[model samples]
Target: MINKGANDLGGFLRSRRERLTPDAAGIEPGVTRRRVPGLRREELAELAGVSVGYYTRLEQGVSTSASDAVIDALAAALRLDPAEHEHLRILATPRRPTRPRARRSKLRPSVRDLLAAIPGSPAIVIDHRADVLAWNRLGHALLAGHVDFDAPDSRVRPNIARMLFLDPHHRALYRDWHAKAQVTVAALHQAVARHPADPGLEHLVGRLAVDSPEFARMWARRPVRTCSSYLRELAHPVVGRVTLVNETVTLPDDDQQIGLFYARPGTTDADALILLAQSFERRLAPGTPSRKEEAR
Candidate 1:
């Protein structure tokens, strides 16, 4: 019996196959018209050194137990990048069924301290669901000062994906909101493949799809992307436009959490960050209501 995972794997393979053209794969387009949009199954099988019948079975969800060598060869034939290769591996493998239990999605105290120790850089830690688990003072100010730093523990947690679309404050925070939205949706797509059995992730996706038409459209496009270090421009209300290299580091000890670090050295952008930090310090003064409280 083909399981949901196997079916999803087959669909992903078919979608990827349809994305490549015969000419792009260095194959003759042929004099006759082609019925398939991209490289045919037989052609892909030949490139991957597998029999056409076996490849067909793989694509049809009849064979889900592909060897690592076969998976690697297929990834090469498809010309997949690092992120795509990782997504392909996730689809081909089945996730072990998770027992129904409440899992703590909190950051470690030591990690929180480490985030605070990084003086000049704005940093925050996020869980697998993109919930801001913990952040330093500057990070809180730069990203979502309007939302409480302790919001992650509350019923209304600050999910990056949710904020990107639903929250006007978060949308206005980005200088290039469209580009950031595309990346955010794509990363969520990859996460769905990685954690197929996670109900929380499923719920988040479903909720966004229902609430935001833009998100629904993007989700339908099936963009697959994972996060990486890249230059980001932020339209910070207090400090104005700020540019920084945003790098997300995955912790091996706590795979569920990713640490996002932002830095801009020796430039006005650095000065902007310092000003933002100072503003956050002012917000913390005695008898001063935080930005979060002022909004209430």
Candidate 2:
């Protein structure tokens, strides 16, 4: 197992250093010698408004407590994208103090009601480990029509990342599987950093690393990504290809995440999504019952 804490810090510094070129950072390359690919330590220190020795120590993983001002300067100097910048902050800072793990209680009545009310949009509430804690009817239909929904404790419940890398059916559903897989692995990497002691997440990562060579390579790359929003191309069997935007909102009280998938209006993709919604409704109609009945 990788020492996630050290790896997170080392990976961020290395990524930032690799991305900043001498030309990009306005540093003139000397004719005498040039060995490093990106910005040299001295040049990066100059750009980041810090001493070369201090920056060197940081890059060496000898120190983690660079002030906010220093972090901002480094972020600006390296020209980090927003997500990368946020990830840098997370990597440099200490994990927030947390209590021992506990089995999360059931969702509040209001949240369940809210999911029920969203008839058209597909949405689900998941835990930190990407376990599908709850899902709206549309969400159930949109993602995994073959699975039973009523039994939340069922072992067969869909895990978004696991499905992305392990299940052929789910992999085929994604038109941009490579990009989606990268983001998924990156987000999981970030989660690993945040929750290093989570055995469940550790086990999941271990399983993926063993089961999928692509996942193993991507995990080795150590990309840190945040799941705020992203676009996905989903190839639904019934709906065909539909471009959807996924947004994640964190629940305040717990380590739960609510994800919403939306398709833009005034497009063929949107029409297909509507058809999918209608198909789901038909499946839930009088004669056609839920999967709970079929299993019995």
lDDT of 2 by residue, 1-296 (tens): 44445355656776678767888888877886777778788888898889999998888878866778988999899888788787777777876667545434356667777887887789998777777777887888778776676745465556778888887887888899999888888878777766766777877788888888898888876776565888888988788888889898988687778889997788786787788889977877767655653543
In candidate 2, which residue pairs clash? none
Best by TM-score: 1
What are the Cα lDDT values of the candidates?
Answer: 0.78, 0.77
Q: Which stretches of candidate 1 lie over 4 Å from their true place?
A: 1-7, 100-104, 286-296
Candidate 1 at 7: error in angstroms?
A: 8.7
List, residue by residue over 1-296, the lDDT tens digit for candidate 1: 11234226677788788888987899986898899899889999999999999999988888865888988999999988787787778777865776632344756878877886885788888876777777776788889999877676577578899999999998998988888888888777776776676677777888888899998887766677776777888998899998888887887566555556466577898889888988888878866765654543
